[model samples]
Target: MKSMKYFLLVLLTLMGAHYVEARPVTLVTLGNSLTAGDGDDGIGGGYPTRLVSKLQTANPGSVLLQFGISGDTTTDLINKQLTPAVAALNAAPSANRKIALVWIGSNDFFGFYNYTITEAWCSGMGLEACENSEFGASADNASTILAALQATGAALYIALLDDQSKRPVITEPALRAATFPNISDEYAARMATHLSAYNSRVQAHADTYGAQTVDFFNTTIFEAPATLSDDGNHPSGAGYDAITDIWHNAVTGSSPSSSSIVPNSH
Candidate 1:
């Protein structure tokens, strides 16, 4: 009788351990079109979908709550998205592990070169001056976003934006002329400088707010034609596939694998 009781206790302990190991996760994704699946219109719905699928293998029944709007700037996220994101985090199961992923500032950077620089607020300034002022405002808003998300008690992961000016849409002359008739080589160069500066601000905020910074700045994935969509601005299906790998590697602290990772949909 004593031996049988000991065996039962050990079996119960092992079952409890298995349950904890497979505890569900609550993942919140926050950003703009890139997070919203702009370029790839396939059923996968971009990185968030693919990421959740990968996460489920380790943590069964993981849930994703995405808050992404196309053309949104840092200011837009602060003004509109934060409240609901917090609500979702709060509503998640008490036992679930919480995480938030933020990838923004692309629109903020693009708007500065395309429109903000020409606005009356920046009327008399040179390219560099206007760029600084515009990106400065964006950086401040981004910091606000990070702070709020950090306060939610979720593990935060923020992605650094690449220099949009170097994208093929702007680098290829014919495409540039078609997209922005008035844009010049000088404008593109100035944009790159300001974008790099803005990325530093983003990195500093991530550090201060206790978020991990996912390095998207140095990847040549965006520069490769095969990774770009027909519009040349967004990532193609293949590009998103590569993006999924990069993000998974960061989250799992594992090397990126080219082999199949997505689970069967059916």
Candidate 2:
């Protein structure tokens, strides 16, 4: 009788352990308007939200907590949010935590706009403006955020900013005619120069902190059809879906297996 009781106790303990191990993971997303799901026709369905939906279907029970605000620069995240949130999560009792997705820096680039210029000078036109945007994240600031997050011991996924030059707000014919009738490709190239610098900084920080970098910069949504969004910039629902596919693959460590998961035509 004594041996049977001991055997039963051991079996019950093993079952409990298995149950605990099967629990879903908890994730957090931190960033700005893009993270907040801005241009998705008010669905609040930005890439992060799309990502959450994908993860839930792929791995049931995974929960995503969002801490994003519109127009938030990288500096804002580090100063106003990241530290406290990290502290709170660290204090939580849950052991099945997985990843933190960070997507910031668009505002930093957009905030560079000062006045209309020919495309010929678009690249340099924003240089002075970019340097002056107080909210912009210097390379050092990005590194700091990465290091702080790393200290919390969570897996990190960092996204690079999309090319801002493609946004309709900057490229629309009507807006361009009204704003700067003589826009030149040079102006666009100059803007690209500054954007490249900022993106490189972000990539360097991710590399330094050992975080995986999502290559949103060169994706088809931005490069092909270039008309990804009606607005010319923020990804349409379809655009966000493409981003979702990229992130899903990054997290799952496997290529997306079906077209059902791919973003529908825009």
Candidate 3:
């Protein structure tokens, strides 16, 4: 009788362990240049990488995947990447896998040259320009991409575009001379207006999809001219690190190393 009781206890413990292990959550990031870390040496060490590192440190068992690429528009992702990736994730053995991060739309705004003639010059020089000239999902075709991702039952986190006016590259005299004959305060304000509409659309989509939104728009670091890199657009390594912290807080509901508990979505 004593032996039987010990055997049953061990069996139950093993079963519990198996149960917990069966439901692994998989996090995936989808986006364009910013998501791909284009301006940051092309190693893909952008915010997604940092976000994954932080999450893994916090939750040892969670799996993270990045599917971001340089110069991919929302239309491109929806047509080329999103479906295939999600299908594969669904087929995986872990029934509890979930997507957790998605940041896009900077390219959409930047492509349009909304702020100044510099963007136009860059496009003229064969650099990637914002394709969404019309503004919002209508412009970038984000609506379909967002909807499909949400349909997969993955919990999502969406980040707003960083303030473009604060980018250092835009103000660089040399780059300015190369890209635009004249970049004025009026041009900057006009660009902001267009980009703001895009950000608003992103937020609206997030709400529609039940995704949590992170507002980089109002963040001091993202809006500070000095925090950007030489190009004046992409975040420096330090800036990316700060963004990682913000994402960590938004998703996990606690700062790094804090005792705050993240609730399971199940």
Note the Cα lDDT for every prediction shown. 0.77, 0.64, 0.63
TM-scores for every predicted model: 0.85, 0.72, 0.73
All models, RMSD in angstroms? 6.6, 8.9, 8.0
Candidate 2 lDDT tens digits, 99-197: 777887766555444442223454564746635343234555778877877777767878876676765555666754554444455555566666777
Clashing pairs in model 3, backbone N/Cα/C closer than 3 A: 111-129, 111-130, 167-232, 168-232, 169-231, 169-232
Candidate 3 Cα errors over 4 Å, as ranges: 1-24, 39-44, 92-97, 114-133, 138-140, 179-185, 223-226, 259-261
Residue 64 deviation, candidate 1, in Å? 0.9
State candidate 1's TM-score.
0.85
Global CA lDDT computed for model 1: 0.77
Which candidate achieves the best lDDT against the true structure?
1
Using TM-score as the yardstick, the better of models 1 and 3 is: 1
Higher TM-score: candidate 1 or 2?
1
lDDT of 3 at 24: 48
Give the alpha carbon lDDT tens digit for every residue of 87-189 in model 1: 8988889877788888889887666666776777677787667777778888877678878877777877888888788788888888777776555787788
- Candidate 2: segments with Cα more than 4 A from true spot: 1-23, 91-93, 115-137, 176-187, 222-229, 258-266
lDDT of 3 by residue, 1-266 (tens): 99985675577467542112223457777877666665554334787887766666645566667787777766667776787757755655455457657677665555455342355554564522333334645434555666777777777777777666555545565655555435455655566776777777777777777878887888866545555566656666677767778877776654566722243442
